[model samples]
Target chain A: MAVVCFMVTMGLYFAATISFLAYLLRRSEALSKVSLGITAAGFVAHTVALVARMVGSSAAAPPSVHEALSFFSWMLILVFLAVEFRHRIHVLGSFIVPLALVSLISAAALPDTVPTLQPMFRTLWLHVTLSMLGTVGFAVAFVAGVMYLIQDRLLKSKRFNVLYSKLPALDFLDDLNQQSIILGFPLLTLGIITGAISAEFAKGAYVSWNPEQTWALVTWLFYFVVLLGRLTVGWRAKRAAYLTVIGFAGVILTLIGVVLKSYGTVS
Target chain B: MHVIVVGLSHKTAPVEIREKLAVPGSRMGEALTRLTSYSGVKEGVLLSTCNRVEVYSVVDDIEQGYGRIQEFLADTHLSLSSEQLTPHLYWHADDRAITHLFRVAASLDSMIVGESQILGQLKDAFESALSHKTTGLIMNKVVKKAISVAKRVRTETKIAEMAVSVSYAAVELAKKIFSDLGQRTVLLVGAGEMAKLAAQHLIAQGVGQVRITTRTPQHAVDLAEKFGGTAVPFEQYKDDMASADIVLVSTGASHYLISADDVQRAVTVRMNRPMFLIDISVPRNIDPAVRHVDNAFLFDIDDLKQRVEKNRAERLQEADKAEQLVVEEVGVLREWMKSLEVTPTIVALKQRADEIKRSELDKTLGRLAHLPAQDRELIEGLAASIVNKMIHGTMVTLKSEVNSSNGAAFVESARRFFSLEAAPPQDTRGESAVDSSSCLAHDMNAPLVEQVPSRTASRKQP
Candidate 1:
């Protein structure tokens, strides 16, 4: 039953991706509405699968690496849909949904392990979920940043195409990038602080610098400087958009390292 | 039974000749009356605009109708003779005339392919003819169908979506940058004519506020007052750029009026908000390097013109789609006209068959007059059913054959075979053939044959 539920979730995400692809090829009001509807359904199915997994786990333990990956994918979709609805950024779905599909597929292909519940893992789950949410926000900002550069290049070159006609203006994309960063930086800071506290409680040595923690701190500092530059020196538009794209890369690398380490510990 | 058009437009006639033939709005009633007064002319509409003057008439004979209309036009301008005007005029008969009118209404034949003015002008001409009572059943149907077809072409095709003028092009570019202009501000510098025109277009597009600045403060105030906007002093205009989403620069100064430093300062104040600067002046009021700023987009006169030309090309491509739609509609209208011509012959054949059935039934009943009442009722029912069965095949054949090429000749032969009296088809119908408004009404709703009137049998109102 769990396998069936997970397969359904993957299938829904794939269907939504196809709709978004059609909307990208030929811009139409009907097709855009359908894409949004399919994405919303896929998001609901993902939530159900994640909840089922958590309930079936031994002693209601926190999610393992595979389960957590699935949950992270779900969080990414939820944040993207929230921003899409609030800004009416219909074109952004064309870029965001395919990334969500990739994450879900990876989650489905990886093997799951039912690790014993550790006493300190509950506190660790809180920091892990918060970190996942922060990375989700940065992923959205990364997509917006890429769109900004493409639009900027198209306008600067004076080459008009179908995609150029459909994409939002550079200003809108840049603003969205900044807003996502502003939303993500604080969550990441809280996530890192809670992570250190949990590590101290579990191992009695929170000050030891692990590679993942070092990378997370570096990623957080990058965004912090970016936000500061934006506030103090008006460093936005192309410059800020590029930095957000780079910062998101740092966040993703750090997440992969953490997920792989957790998987190794389970094995 | 034929649609005829005879007139001169921008294509064939010089402005002097067209102006001479044009009937102004004040004289439209007189022109329409004269048009319908021509020999063999049944219904008429006069369309007179600055670019073209045309008379569309539903007439009996195309040859006589064209000659009469040409003479009428020459007489309107007494300085010219029919021969002198004939060289500049072009005439279309039947199917060609229908196609021409549809193309005109759809704006395919316009000087600018997708211009919207011609449609409105055509509508006004139709309403004028309608109000003058010079149009009857056929003209009414044709005009309404033309309007509906034009509307379809507009919605189904993108012929009118592109901007062809420089002022409109600026607004189009602005919309691409800003989705909603309702809360955006526009600042006009120099108060020049081009700037004023662009500002007006921006206002018409629903920009929030318009501020004008000029070398002479009074001129700025006067221009701003005309558009219901505020005027800023020339010295303070640089500072005002911080609040503006779009700036139209058209100063007469030879030097660059807005430098990169000025724009950088404005960006700092606005926290890098996007600003669109349009330089319509030949001397280039805004420095081109200002475009290098973070959120500044600058367009010069040449750039706007190029964009306009590109859009015009796209409109031409879209016009091809609109023309195809017009061709299809014309074919449908041609089929409808053919059905109108065959209606009279069909009605005559049915009437003749019914007369024979009634006479035969009377004779049979008289011969069986001594029969029982039940036997008499049985004979009447059987005879009526036989008559209906005989007429059904003939009615179906006639209706289907009306769409064929040799339909009129076929209809004529059928009339003669039934020993029916032959009359001119156009004169058979009241007012005009093709009172298709009734047919349209029937098709639009419940399919009740009771509402289908024998319009061809009625006489023309005296």
Candidate 2:
């Protein structure tokens, strides 16, 4: 049942991506509504699937790459929907929903083993989940940054229809970038702290200095500096938007390092 | 009845030619009266808008109806000779006319496809025809169905959702930038006509405050009074830009009035808040480099015009989708019309059955002349009930089949199999005869139902 629901969630996400893309071309309110509804439905299915997986898998098993990726995409959509409803930027889905699909597709490409979660009854799972959500926040900022660049280009180039009309305002995308970073930074701080404490619990050392651990700290510092710049001097979205890409790079590297480590242990 | 449409639209004739042949609203009743006065026309409607002038009518003969409507068109617009008018007028008859009406109502045939103005115009024209009493059962059904088809197109296709006009495009862009125009302030620079129209549009969108500035102080002051706002001196407009969220510049001056440095300084004064600059002047009053300024978006007239062009292209694509919907609805209306044609046949078949039953009952009764009165009454009831039950089944099946795809074929076969056309439903051996038997042959101009409406009110002495 868990596996079936997981596939169903993937299918719903695919449909949502297509609908959002279609809405971009047509620019109709009805299509936007339908696209949002589909995304909401997909989010529901994702939650159900995750709950079913938790119910099915044994508690002692550690987190697999598949489960981590699934939760990451799920958290991204959760934040995306909250922002969408608050702002009513229908076009935002065109920029964000496809990223969810890409994440889900990556997860699907991995093995179908039900990832029960981490460290049995230990707090290490908290560490994994928090860090994953922190990465999701950065991913949201990255998507917003990408949109800002595209809108900025379209405005500067004087292309005033289709994609230009369908995109959110430059200022709105900029504000969103700042807001997501502001939200994500604290979670990332706590996420790193929890990871350090859990490292001490699991391997009897506070600092493991492993590839994933090093990458996570580096990514955290990068976003910390970014948040400081935005808070202190009130930097524009374009600069922060361009800078978020480096933080996103750190996220990708950390995920890769963890997945490789998990494969070495599981196989 | 045959439905015919004769008209000219923006596609066929230039506005100059259309204006010469146009009929205004005040003359609609008189024009419709003259239209139905023609020998072939039985019911009529005249639609006159700036883009097109058309006449929709039900007629006895398609060819002669077109000729008669053409004659009426010629009579109304004597300034334009037949040589000039004949080249522009288009005529459609029967099902094609219905399809044409649907397309027009749905705005597929408009100067700007997917515009909603045509639908309102069509409804107004239809209402005029309704009030003038120029419409009967067929015209009413066709026009009403056309209106519904237009509505269906609007809901089923995203044709009219986007703005295709330049002024409307500006508002759409503003909404994209600001999300809410209610708190935004607009600074109007120069008083060009088109720029003022756009400013009025922005004001209508509930922009917070409007400030007008022009080279002439009196014109600025008067325009400010008209717009319910204050006017600033032309030299002091730059200071006003700091508080303004939107600035519209249109002047005949060859040099750029608002330069990149000015916009840069304004953004600083507003603490980097976004400013929307629109330049509609010929030489362009705002500097193009203002777009490079942080949070400043500048659009010239050509940019808005380009946006309008792109929006028009998008609407045309949606128009294709709307056209498909219209075609589907036309099929539905055509099926309904075929069923309407079957009503008369259904009535005729029942009448023939009744005549046969009565005649045979008379023969049997004459043979049993010495039978008891009670037994004769019993026999009469039995024969009437049996015939009624049989005809009821056949009529129900016939009515049900008339709306199907091959309904016309079944109706034709039923007419032939029952020999309904060869023998009219009147009893030849009886004293009473229906003098309206001429209506039995399915005359296109004749009433489909049994009751012929008194159309005398529709045709006056004029």
Candidate 3:
């Protein structure tokens, strides 16, 4: 039953991703609405499956890397759906749904060997949740940044085609990107701070110079520069969009590094 | 039917000619009634604007309607011969008339291409005819399609982007230069009609100051006071031009009023600041050579018209997409019209077949009065099956014929051949049951339950 539920959730997630991509390519509003509907259903199913697995294991926390990864992916999808519902930005799903599907598929393929919860694992869970929330924010910002660049280019070239016609205004896209960054950057800072505190709480002594921690700090600094540049230099729309794309790239690298380090240490 | 459009426009005739033929709004209804009642005319719609007064109509005889409409116009107001009116009057047959209406509604045929006001005017004329019931089926379809086409063009094209008139062009140029024109100053020279119009545009753009000048100081003061600007003498016009960022010159002189030297001095006095000068006069008031001076941007009438032409071209490109949508919608409406023609014939044919079954059953019942109830029921079911088999081929043929071009005539023929003119009593029970079920479905959270399973069961059992 657990495996069936997991497979169903993953299938719905992948189907939603494909539909969202179709909506972007074809620009069919009907397809976008359907994609959002599918994503909502998949989110509900995924939540049920996660709870079922936790209950089946009878564990206070996630027992394995697969479970932890699944939890993180589920959290990302939930955050994405919540934002989509609140903001009503159907285009963001074109980027986010695919990422969620990839995460789910990867989590499903990983070995499910349960790892004993060391005292530090609880601290690790907190770190994972915060970083995941921060990454979701970055993902949304990246979508807005891409739209802003495309819209700005079209407007500059004076070629107002249907694709450009369908997009939000240049000013709106720019503001959306800035607002996402503003909300995300502080959450990211708090996430990194809480992560350090967790590390200190678990190890009795601070662990320093880890590549994941170093890269995370670097990602934070990149966004901090972006926020500062926006505040001080009166950064133009295109420039801010480019910075967002660069900052998000740093974020992805940090996430990969963190995942790889955890896998290496666990094995 | 022959369609003739007569009257004058800004192209062939002046406003004085058009205004003489223009029917006032109060007299429009009486005009339409008179036009429809005229000899050889079947339907009529009159379009009267400041530029043109054209009567569009379908007539029984082409030359006769032409002569009647010409005589009617001659008798009403304009005492002109057919020879005089014939040159300006354009006569169109079937397809030309349709295309003319389409172009007029789309604003392509207007004096100003893509001007949206003409479309609204056309719609008002159409609705007036509709209210008076003067339009026939052909005009109804044509007017509705034209309105839809106009709407599609407006949405799909950028044709209505910038102002086309020279006065509006001057305003638009200022807007492009300064996104917010609330602080700009405008200087008007000569206080001519063109200059006054330019001042209106400047004030609309939120100009901070409007300064006017003329050879006659009283005229300049009167115009300045009207538009909330200060008046200055013609001798100080160059000085006022230095203070103004936008200057409109429309003087009545045959020679250049503002020489290149005058603008050159103003450019220096203004510290090489950019100035927009619009000269909307035939005997150009600003020197043609002044355009070469640094920071002095000059636009004559021809230059402004050229920009308007470019904007019109861009709008035409967008109209192509909109035209495709209109064509698609028209095709859909045509299909619905065809289907509507087939419906009544099919219903009547079914009723005829059912009536024959009921009469035969009544005759059989009289003969089988002595038979048992079970045997009588068996015989009745067998008779109904035979009747169904007999009409099945004809029903299939009717359904196939509906998809053809002559489908309406074919259905009419079928109804006559089958003696099925009278409609059968409608069964309200089944319809009421369906309506109630739909209401129940609406009240509930789920969709209307699919009847496929029950339908399949009935098919298999039968």
Top DockQ prediction, candidate number: 1
Model 2 ranges with Cα > 4 A deviation: A26-38, A58-61, A84-88, A111-121, A200-209, A265-267, B1-164, B212-236, B268-272, B310-462
State the TM-score of the second chain for every model.
Answer: 0.54, 0.55, 0.50
Please name the candidate that would achieve the greatest TM-score relative to the true structure: 1
Identify the leading candidate in terms of lDDT: 2
Model 2: per-residue Cα lDDT at residue B447: 20
The DockQ score of candidate 3 comes to 0.01
Q: Candidate 1, residues B1-462: lDDT per residue as tens digits?
A: 578898888788775677567665667888888878776777888887646788888877789988888878887889877877889999998889888998888878765455565666676677678767777656665666677677778779886554236678788778766767888999998754456667889999999999988666676787789888899988899999999989999764546889989998887888877788899764577999986876777888777766667556566678888998988887776655664576776787777878887899899999999999999889887877787788777677777875443344466556656677643223211121221111101111222111223334322231
Model 1 chain A poorest ten-residue lDDT run: A113-122
Between prediction 1 and prediction 2, the one with superior DockQ is 1
What local distance difference test score does each model get?
0.74, 0.75, 0.65
List, residue by residue over A133-157, the lDDT tens digit for candidate 2: 7778889999888888787777767
- lDDT tens per residue, model 2, B1-462: 578999998789876677667776557789988887777687887877656889999886799888999889988888887778889999998889989999998878864456565665665666668877777656776777777777777778776564236567677667666766888888888765446767888988898888988766776787799888779888899988998988888664546788999998888777566778888665567988897886788888778767777556666677788888878877776665554467888887888888988899999999999999999999999998898887777678777875443344466567777777632111122211111111110111222111222233332211
> lDDT-based ranking, best first?
2, 1, 3
Interface RMSD of each: 2.1, 2.3, 10.4
Q: Model 2 chain A — which ten-residue stretch has the worst lDDT? A: A112-121
Angstrom error at residue B153, model 3: 16
Candidate 1, pairs of clashing residues: none
Candidate 3's docking class is: incorrect
